[model samples]
Target: MTTEANSKSEEGHDPFFDHVPERRGTHSLKWDKYQDPYVLPFWVADMDFRSPPEVIEAVKQAGAFGNFGYGKPSPKLVDTVIQRMQERYDWTIEPSWIVWLPGMVCAFNLALRTHGQPGDEVLSAVPVYPPFLTAPANFEQKLVKVPLILDGERWTLDFDALEEAVTARCKTLLFCHPHNPVGTVFTREELQRLADFCLRHDILVCSDEIHCEMILDEDSKHYPLASINPEIADRTITLMAPSKTFNLPGFGCSFAIISNSELRARYKKARAGIVPDPPAMGLTLAEVVYLHGEPWRKRLMNYLRSNRELAYERLNEMPGLQAFRNAATYLTWIDARKLEVENPCRFFEKHGVGLSDGSDFGTPGYLRLNLGCTRSLLEEGLDRMEAAVNSL
Candidate 1:
């Protein structure tokens, strides 16, 4: 399991060749599910790239030590999380405040089961990740969707509409910070406004900040919703994971920061027997990466920034395609409303590119593209997209 870093180049090397291995026949969601050889799969949020060299090395080191059993997270791993939070977001967190989970999706499901009743309404913004809408349903909770306003090329919340949507039936408000499928790293002001509104209505906020570390814009910063105000902190469940940042989703390691003691108790009570612990290897790698992989992460971020630029320029050139430049995450939300095709993903699949359908994300006539790939694969996907759009 030798790992190599891409040599820094002027125009950037192909990320597909540089980072991602050909994932065919590997049971990879991003690759295996799409059997069409021509369809360049970019549906799942996971990158087509490999994890950082240091991360791979760390995982290898852990694997070399042959001990596989039920394990508790090491104190070092807990400390690593605390340090990363302080360094990255300037948010201080105690070890006791951290509640470990197998995955962020699990955290979402647990949140609904913990706080809301079977028929209580769970609210979230539209054009978000599919799980945000489906999580509530899993627990038989009603889901209330508030559509985000697309003002020009940016997606923003209509606070007035959101206020109208929040009612006695709505007990929880799930937020996607640095929103998935629509790449908007919310401003601090916007976050404050949201916090204020939720506080006034006494609605508990569950924020998923899993993509907090992949921010591409230098001017943009990620603000944890709980850090905005004490009231918000008392009522918020901040979900985060190393999966998205370190490309370790397969490892199944995620945690929630529950600031308020009562809220923590309730969340823990819901998981008294059901929620399984994160894998020992995942915790080991998470600890090692946090301690020694900062330099590698810096280099990776630089590479992703370049990829984001390349995708932005290439997609903008297509006739009926439009993409909003994102602040964080390798996933890019594309506006394909102008296209004549009924199903954008299917249309792209015909052209040898597979994209996540926007309708699944609660926004039709749009598509989401994963930019976490080798430059060659990205270019090929873009070229296919151009040909498809041209033929239209």
Candidate 2:
């Protein structure tokens, strides 16, 4: 890296993230999943860094009160969300439009339930987050997968394929913005084209925007798929949260933004009776992060951007591996088809590096590596991967 690039990379890296917490014995899903003590985990979306100090302090304050009870989102948190939309995206929304969910996966199932009948089809581009593939089946609806084509360096939607794939039973499109597995931030032109396509097909769009805040490319910006136009907004249900941005997934808090009252009503009805509200701590942390998490978020993004560059450069150099640059998120998607191995995930685990299997994301012969760890740890994992592939 050039000196200027190096300086830019270190712009806002917080010293706090340097101290990775010891999570092995804490019943962590990522760390404790493997019995081997030397295997480094890079499979899950969970980050190794602690939550923002402000969020931790807020948690402490809540602990002092010592009363854990069922709770609803407060007025302040709702208002903060409203303000965040307007300030960040210039998209204005009313408080009544927010429908809280315990997690984005629940929102996915609810989107299918509210918009489609059993046996209807849910349209989505693969490879995507695993839930998008299974949510349709959970609702007895069929999932129609459209492969995203590799256009140069980035993976993008195939409009022609999408048009050919849509049928009368296709009722909803489960879209992932700043998409998982393969990170690609759709351009405004692309989103506009998608909005037009959905409008033409009379398809409801359930956009998963969980990684909106982690844009790694300086030139890229996130536009809520619903924010494209008033018409699209009416047919769109956008899922967002502070969990991915603030490292608070264990709290289980997320929400859906629905501009159309009728659609919003259907969503709420689908989630009623069974879907539980977010815990009190989740709501409180959300409030604090939205109100005060910007500084920490900026620092964390800087650190992850550096890690992303390192991983991309290093992984692509491996003889049988290919890695693409991510426009957003702390995940790097790698293609390992050429490697002389049957299962890449298990193969790497044997080499002391655990990666998310691409088969789980509807694409075999590929792997998703989490880049959201301390710099030293990321370096160690990359070193292990490099040596493993070199040996092969």
Residue pairs in collision within model 1: 15-374, 15-375, 16-374
Looking at candidate 1, what is the lDDT of residue 279? 84
lDDT of 2: 0.91
TM-score of each: 0.96, 0.96
Candidate 2 structure, TM-score to reference:
0.96
Best by lDDT: 2
Query: Where is the poorest 10-residue window by lDDT in model 1?
Result: 1-10
- Which ranges of candidate 2 are over 4 A from the true structure? 1-14
Say what the RMSD of model 1 is. Answer: 1.9
lDDT of 2 by residue, 1-392 (tens): 11322233343244677667899889999999899999999989999998888887788887899898888899999999999999989999999999988899988889898999989999999999998999999888999999999999999999999999999889999999989988999999999999999999999999999999999999999999999999999999999999999999999999999999999998899888989889888998999989888877877888898889889899998988999899999999999999999998898999999999999999999999998898888999999999898778
